[model samples]
Target: MKIFKKSDIILIFAVLFVAGIIFAISSLEKGPPVAHIIVGGEEYKAVNLVDIPEKQVFILETHPETIIVCEKGCAYFSSAGCPDKICVKTGRLTKKGDTAVCLPAGVVLTIEGGEYDAVTY
Candidate 1:
């Protein structure tokens, strides 16, 4: 005697298909998120990336000062006074979990994602 029937197989496949779709969609990010700037290993500034698509420029009053620019939903250090402009060259961080580090300036810019905080600890 067969233990499984044709309907059972179809239902199983359908459930698995829907579950896969739900998982994929849920795993995607909610939307563009804010990025946190860390200075000297301490949280310094929080900027919402979505608002920066206009490519506006600003300054972060770090010890050496960091010039920041936002463009296309990404943020980066355009200029700095550190001996090595590594942070300025690191380029813009756009996606969640993307990070740019400026060791000389003691700055870390990390993308914010999901419910958990990227800066609190």
Candidate 2:
């Protein structure tokens, strides 16, 4: 028995072609890297990662206390007040669309504006 029939192969190729086109368009629209800090569901600050002159740390207004650090072209949660500390474990947010969230503190740090190649399972 044939593994992939003629129609099946054609459909697979067509899907890949459309995916490539969408990826290309999305890549072309990317901008410079930026990090946005949100507190209590509101945007607290937006930092241009590419324009950072030096490493910086910020303490947000949250219970338990949360800290974020940014340098060069990346940002990350250095510390979090939540017991889980999952946000701190998230490491660096170097790529666009990367996010670190501390649920208890109501804080989120996300990277915005940059090219993302692909996400693999």
Q: Residue by residue across 1-121, what tens digits does model 2's lDDT show?
A: 8998999999999999999997666546577788999999889999988768999899987997999999987899998878999999999988777889999999989987874453355
**Where does candidate 1 clash, by residue pair?**
none
Error of 1 at 33 (Å): 2.0
lDDT of 1 by residue, 74-98 (tens): 7788889888787878887777767
The segments of candidate 1 whose C-alpha lies over 4 angstroms from its true place after superposition are 1-31, 51-56, 114-121
Judge candidate 2 at residue 33 and give its lDDT. Answer: 80
**Candidate 2 global CA lDDT score:** 0.87
TM-scores of the candidates in the order shown: 0.58, 0.72
- Full-model lDDT for every candidate: 0.74, 0.87
* Candidate 1 structure lDDT: 0.74
